[model samples]
Target: MSVVIEQPKSPRSRKAANWEKYGWMYMRASGAILLILIFGHLYVNLFVGQGIKGIDFAFVAGKWANPFWKVWDGLMLWLALIHGTNGMRTIANDYAERPMVRKVLNYTLWIVCAALIILGTLVITTFDPCIDPNASTYLPGVCAVK
Candidate 1:
């Protein structure tokens, strides 16, 4: 006797948005971009400077003073946070047997991610290299008087 297997999922409707597909695509795109951003960040901070010994508050202040670095770091922060949260969401969907638990977990994950991204972006944008009390010690060029 011949047997026929039924289709697992119904065809998607044109009106409905495919969030899973979008999320999957986002993971791939963000992951590739994150690799470049992360590696470049490491190369600049570690190799271009005095290596590990050269990293300090002053180094961070100097880096944040530049708009380019601020934007780069912001991008890295936002992308990484979202990518990680999406990954966690996927895991929850896969492993969590209860629907309510999965929903709660995903909601909590996204909320935390949103909070961190907002705070991190604010830090990057509002960072004042010259805000140090010991200006000469932390950022000699910008905060110290000549």
Candidate 2:
């Protein structure tokens, strides 16, 4: 039996801007940064001080109280969301045969990502450690004074 292989199609004739190139570069860059951000987050949350046992609302509140951690977490949130969305877009482009389906899937992915990014940014920027009145008992000593 003989097997036949078809040659790939030629590139598009129009010389449009290379978005895929940029997306590929972004994936590499973001993956590297994400490695650092994820590992640092894990180290701080799981290995420092009392470790996992120390994780609580108060612990999160304490971390977000600092601007550095806030920016770090916010950056992680945005980058991860964008990176994941873009990766999924690439997959949808490859696997989805219908153009409308691909468009809908991509749009949904982007909308969800945008919403989460906005909500996450707002939370990171406007978070108040002492906002809860009923949970004061579970809060840290700092919340009592605030």
Candidate 3:
């Protein structure tokens, strides 16, 4: 594939910041990082020890007990959500013929993305494994009895 770089419309004429260019770059960079994060996540959750059978509430509690896993999962959530939303926005802009429809779709897409990112980050950062006292049967190892 041949790539053509766009020159300034006029010689020495500075152009405003190119958002589409940055968005494309972000998609590429986030995709590479998400590749590693996702594979590592899958390997740890599905390939380590008893594999899928061992994945339970306790397994997740234990994993989230450490700060490292929290950050790793958080990064994955944020990157994946944004990457998917940006792709959708690009599709909307390209395919939606009506300006009003494109505008509404882009706005809705970003709104949903922001809401999900906020909620997911809250879940990851504020997750408490020992929230329920009655469900200590499986979480006993991860949580201490009061």
Candidate 4:
């Protein structure tokens, strides 16, 4: 007796637009962009000035004060979260045996990703270093002067 392996049937309804293809392209594009963004971020934070020792709340505040860094960080947060969520979705589709389980996992992944992206963007965009009254001693001279 021999066991027979059968190929899965294709979907009967074909969509005019291909989402899987778009998702594949997005992964490649986002990965390239993330490589540059992550490296540049590391170089600036870890290699510049006093190196790793220079990283502090004040340092982050100073960076966020600049519109350029704000955009950079925001883009990085959004891209990375979406990229991760998409990757997890693909994994779920491939490995999840139950349709309900796959659907629940994918939904949870996107919900968490969306929530984090929103919170991170808000923090980056609205960060105020001078808001803490007790932080004057730990904060930079600029915060005290302001």
- Say which candidate scores most in TM-score: 1
Provide the overall lDDT of each model, using Cα atoms, as 2-decimal numbers: 0.82, 0.84, 0.85, 0.83
- The TM-score measured for candidate 4 stands at 0.84
- Residue 83, candidate 3: how far off, in angstroms? 0.6
Off by over 4 Å in 4: 1-15, 133-141, 144-146
Root-mean-square deviation of each candidate, in angstroms?
Answer: 5.5, 5.7, 5.0, 5.2
Q: What tens-digit string does per-residue lDDT give for candidate 4 at 1-146?
A: 22221222323335445566677778999999999999999999999999999988888877876899999999999999999999998888778877788779989999999999999988987888878776666765546643
What is the per-residue lDDT of model 1 for residues 1-146, given as tens digits with 9 covering 90 to 100?
A: 22222222445559876677777789999999999999999999889959878998788887877789988999999999999999998878778877778779989999999999989988887777665576866467657664
Residue pairs with backbone atoms closer than 3 Å in model 4 (clashes): none
TM-score of 3: 0.86
What ordering of candidates by TM-score runs from best to worst? 1, 3, 4, 2
lDDT of 2 by residue, 21-123 (tens): 6677789999999999999999999999999999988899888877999999999999999999999988887788777888799899999999999999999
Higher-ranked by lDDT: 1 or 2: 2
Predicted candidate 3 versus true structure: per-residue lDDT over 37-126, tens digit per residue: 999999999999999999888898999989999999999999999999999988887788777888899999999999999999999888
In candidate 1, which residue ranges exceed 4 Å CA deviation?
1-12, 144-146
lDDT of 1 at 8: 23
